[model samples]
Target: MKRKKILFFIYTMGKGGAARTLLNVMNNLDRNKFEPMLVTLNHDGEYEQYVNEDVQFIKLEAKRLRSGILPLAKIIRKEKVDIVFSTIPNYNMVAILAKMLSFTRAKVVVREADHVGGSLLGNLKCLVYGRFYNRTDQVISLSEGVKQNLVEKYKLKPNAIEVVYNPLDIENIKQQIEIGELSKEVAPIFNQNEKVIVTAGRLVKQKDHDTLIKAFAETNEQVKSQLVILGEGPLEEELKSLAQKLNVEDRVHFIGFQDNPYIFFHEADLFVLTSIHEGFSHVIAEALASGTPVVSTNCKSGPSEVLANGEYGDLCPVGDPKSISEAMTETLTLPPEALQMRVSKGEERAQFFNANKIVSRYGQVILNTFKK
Candidate 1:
């Protein structure tokens, strides 16, 4: 039997969630059963290093997305792809276009990665999503929370959307180490014998790096540790100013966009996420895989779900610096032996989101879509 040709599409490989998820899926999918291909709306950004040897990538020159319809149609027709999977927002529009123009019987699968802002236009998107999304045969969401949003806001048929938690490369996390002590090349911008707290994602309003700055500033003098944030974005200067204003600038280091965040995950003393909202926080899984103790905000959707309602990591109320400070201070005091025990728990829990399991779920969804 011939292998199914599946094309994974994304807007751009910008350093955040969707791009990383697609990159990991492409890297780990079974080559014998599926011929994976990729389409990037813009050729720019990282994660290209992880694209599989067998998978092909096309850099569509869509200066304005209006230009993409003709070109995207050409690629779908050329590849004769069986399925086109789109991630996040605008790219879904692009995938729908390709599906409309393709000569091949290509199905479209769109994944929703965020919950809040989406609901605003979600009703609007769902109208299109309902009219056309069902045309793809299936839609995948990163969390049950997001799936509920899709169903509630869009009145989507329950059967139309499947919740597949985003995958983390646990083997890579295990092999590489959570707070990587092995390689300085990808190390989180600072050398610290002190207790280390790490967070990864863009520095922005939603990520709430400012809350982390205030929390770290309040860490009692007796506790020895540093806070590190990974990823670069529009809020860089503002976050730096907030750190300086909070007087924790020395202790709060923003290491702009890292290609090798896994090393930081491996070696860190504790992992923390301060996001205001998320489809799912990928770093939390990375931290769990790294075996580092994790502290996070009880953000609306992803963190609470990923933590299994707080069994996997410590949860503090969102935007509360005092609570976050106390949590970090407590985690900082844990003995290495006890810390290892916590890390062991994380390793077991992280298996739920392991890369292969999630990718297989993705493949299965695409196949099931065609069955109907």
Candidate 2:
């Protein structure tokens, strides 16, 4: 019997949530039922090793977004794919056009991982694309907050948009834990239990690393915990200068682009995320899975939802450094058992985003959609 084909469409195979989520779907999809393939706009980025070797990977050179969809649709037909899943914004716009052109009865799944609120330009763009988004067979958001945002801002039918949390490779991470401390095969950050405060995400305005720098600087220097920012991007210089201006230049370290980020979580005294807003913060789950304590800004949507309204980790007002610092200081003073409880809480919540479970949801969505 011929097998069904599934294609994951992505902007890039970069080390971001969208790419990682695409890999999660590819890795965990039942092989007996579906054959997985990856279609990426660009091939450059992290986490390439995580993609299953059985799956075919094809990269279409970047071009004018509209022009590229026609070619991408050609690949879909050539691959005989039954479904095309796109996770980036422009890719969604392209996915609709491509599938329409293919005329091959392929289902198009558009997943939005970016925070919809807190960005005027983003919300406006979503409005313009509101009517066209209906062309997608299904629209997936990472959090309920995003789901609501889409419904309210774009007047999308709530039923049409599904909230599928980002999948974390929990069992894989646990297996790597057994391998050794060097999970990523990358060198460790070389700091011993030096009260590390760590955050990992692209250095973008939404991540608000500059706010984290200010907050860390305000924390009592007597604690003297090191501030480490993982991941790299456009805001590196501005964030570094903020660290300097806050007089925490020597204290804050910008460790750009660590492929294996969990090691820092394991080694750190506290894991922190200062994102101004997020659709969902998958790194929080990773930190918990690594048995690390966490703290984050009470950013719209993800952090509070992931932290169970502060049950899993301490929450500070977004962009408020002193409040964040105070929360971190208080977290540092908690009893060791309390920290353990927090870690356990985070680990407990991590189950909701386990790789197999999330992948299963995708499988169900795909099969159900096709059945329709």
Candidate 3:
């Protein structure tokens, strides 16, 4: 029997949550049943090396999104793709438009990767959400909160939206954690006898690392802990300066982006997230799978769901340094037995987002696109 071909579209295969989740889905799909193809705007991302040999990879090399639209449509028509799965808002719009221009029976599934809340692009974004989004065969939302936002803000029909959580390669994460160790430069930070707190994400306004640094400063005053930020972005110098101004620069380590963040997640005493909003947080789930306790700001959609409303980890109010600091101190100070119990429960919670189970759900969604 001929296998169905699925083309996954994204802007780039960068070290972001959506790219990681998309790669996980592509690598784990049943090869016998489906042929996976990845299409990116250009071949400029860290994840390019990780693409499976079985997956057909293409780069349009378009300088911008508008320029790539025609090339994408041509690929859709020429390859006779059975389905097109696209994530991120702008990319989603491009995929939908490309499918329209292709003029083929191939289905298009646009995945919404964030809670736009109707303000991201102002009127233009809202118009696209209301017009083009519903026009697609299906819309994949990362959480119930995102789905609700679509319906309320954009007035999308509920039946057209499906809430699909992002998948994690939990087994590979555990393996990497087992074999991975701290580098020579970073090893000393872990050896300082200070309770190590780690957070991984781009240093941007959305991540709200400013609040995290402040909270870390507060946590350090009482706990003798250190903060290790694992990702890099525009705010690097500013954040480092904040740490210095707060007098915790000696305790804060900006290690940039590590190829294997799972190692840091596993070795750290605690993992924290201070994002302003998220579709679904892969890092929190990763920390849970790594057997580390987590403290996260209760963001719009993902964290509360992943942590099960603070059952598996502590959830504090967003952008509140004092509350976050209190939670950090309390979680770090839990008794050994109590901490172990929470970690065990968190490990179980993380399994629900495991790739093995979540991939099949995506497969079903892809199939449903054709039916509609």
User: TM-score of every model?
Assistant: 0.92, 0.93, 0.97
> Sorted on lDDT, highest at the top, how do the candidates line up?
3, 2, 1
lDDT by residue (1-372, candidate 1, tens digit) is 577888888777768778989888878777776898888766687778767777888889885666777788889888888878888767777788777987667877888888754555646766665566656667888998888877776677887789888888877766655444634543444464567778888877998888888888887465866777888889999888887887677777777777777777776788888888888888888888777789999987888898998898899999999999898888888887887788899889899988888888877777787678
Model 3 weakest 10-residue run by lDDT? 117-126
* 1-372: candidate 3 lDDT, tens digit per residue: 578999999989988888898999999998887999999996599888888998999999795898889999999999999899999878888998999999998888888877775465564566666688878888889899888878877788999899989998999899889899899999998898779999999999999999999999999988999899999999999999999999999988998987789999888999999999988888999999999999999998889999989988999999999999999999889999998898899899999999989998998887877666
RMSD in Å for model 2: 2.4
Off by over 4 Å in 3: 118-124
Stretches of candidate 1 off by over 4 Å are 118-131, 177-192, 220-222
- Candidate 3 accuracy as TM-score: 0.97
lDDT for 220 in candidate 2 is 42
TM-score of model 2 relative to the true fold?
0.93
Estimate candidate 2's alpha-carbon lDDT, on a 0 to 1 scale: 0.80
Residue pairs with backbone overlap in model 3: none
Give the alpha carbon lDDT tens digit for every residue of 149-264 in model 2: 78887668999988888888988777666664643322344444457788899999889887788778877475777777788899888888888787888777777776677767
* Model 2 lowest lDDT segment of ten: 182-191
On lDDT, the stronger of 1 and 3 is 3
